[model samples]
Target: MAATKERALEAAVELLGTDGVRALSHARVDERAGLPAGSTSNWFRTRRALLGGIIDWMAEQERADFSPALLERPTPETIIEGLCTVFLLETGPFAARTRARYALFLELAADDELLAPLSRQRREFERWTDRLVTEAGIPDPVPAARTIMALGDGLVLHRLTVDPELDARPVIERAVRALAASVG
Candidate 1:
């Protein structure tokens, strides 16, 4: 049962990411997952349920990819390196997941009920960033964290949608250095 659901969600991610929200449906997921008829619907009765499951699954996948050790003792260099690595993954190897996430971000923007779970993960990340910057000696850690997160998100979006080959390391380094300088 769990395996079936996992396959369904994985297929749903690929479908939603590669083809956009319009391409998502129980039949498509079932076909893509190679499950029998009605299998997807058995697990997810509605489109909303399927979407929510995908959101949770994606959050889990991303969390697993992001190791806590990377930012354990955040410094400007570590932060820049971490962000650059994340940028590369998001725009390259993990582009499909990024696209799926952005699709959900837009599709669920007006639906608070559906958006809440997605936003929860983002909030936790922001809190983590807050702690990271604080540990790095940023006096105004909260806003700095937000700025950093926003900048990273924007850069990833641009890389995914605008240019797949954009090298964002220099931009990330400059930004991190500026943030660090603000403290000194």
Candidate 2:
């Protein structure tokens, strides 16, 4: 049997996509997981732990496909395609729940409820981002990552919301080429 804590985190992660942070609650999570009442608290002991679990879960899912090979043999096309795939995942089948969790993360940013795990992931994320941006030979990795993240996020959001059948494949390819050109 999956631990109640794991189950709760999964529920919270799923809920984040559509509901945002405010929607998370022990009651709602338990219900979402179809667990018996009180199971969430029974396992996690506190709401803080539960919230931390969700952040950890999200970070895990987000980077599941990343590898160092991409850095060793970097290609603008691959970097762009890899990022686009991750971006699509965030906005599509898994989006609603991530949205809900993100809302909670934003609401509880100052709270220790999500500090440790999220911090760990943030460090790793920055490292990976640095690799990609540096490999691209960009002037600044921070700005490069920020620009890429923003562009990809907007594109995915538009693809998911404004246009049901938006053909972003060509756009993505072109954009990657442009980014590569800026580097060279």
lDDT of 1 by residue, 33-118 (tens): 99998999998899988888889999998888886677788988889988998888888778888899999989889999889988
lDDT of 2 at 44: 69
146: Cα error in model 2, Å: 2.7
Q: Which parts of model 1 are misplaced by more than 4 Å?
A: none
State the TM-score for model 1. 0.95
lDDT of each: 0.88, 0.69
Q: How many backbone clashes does candidate 1 have?
A: 0
lDDT of 1 at 47: 91
Evaluated against the true structure, the overall lDDT of model 1 is 0.88
Query: Residue 118: error of model 1 in Å?
Result: 0.9
**Per-prediction TM-score:** 0.95, 0.77
Q: Name the best candidate (by TM-score).
A: 1
Q: Which TM-score value belongs to model 2?
A: 0.77
| Per-candidate count of clashing residue pairs (backbone under 3 Å) | 0, 12
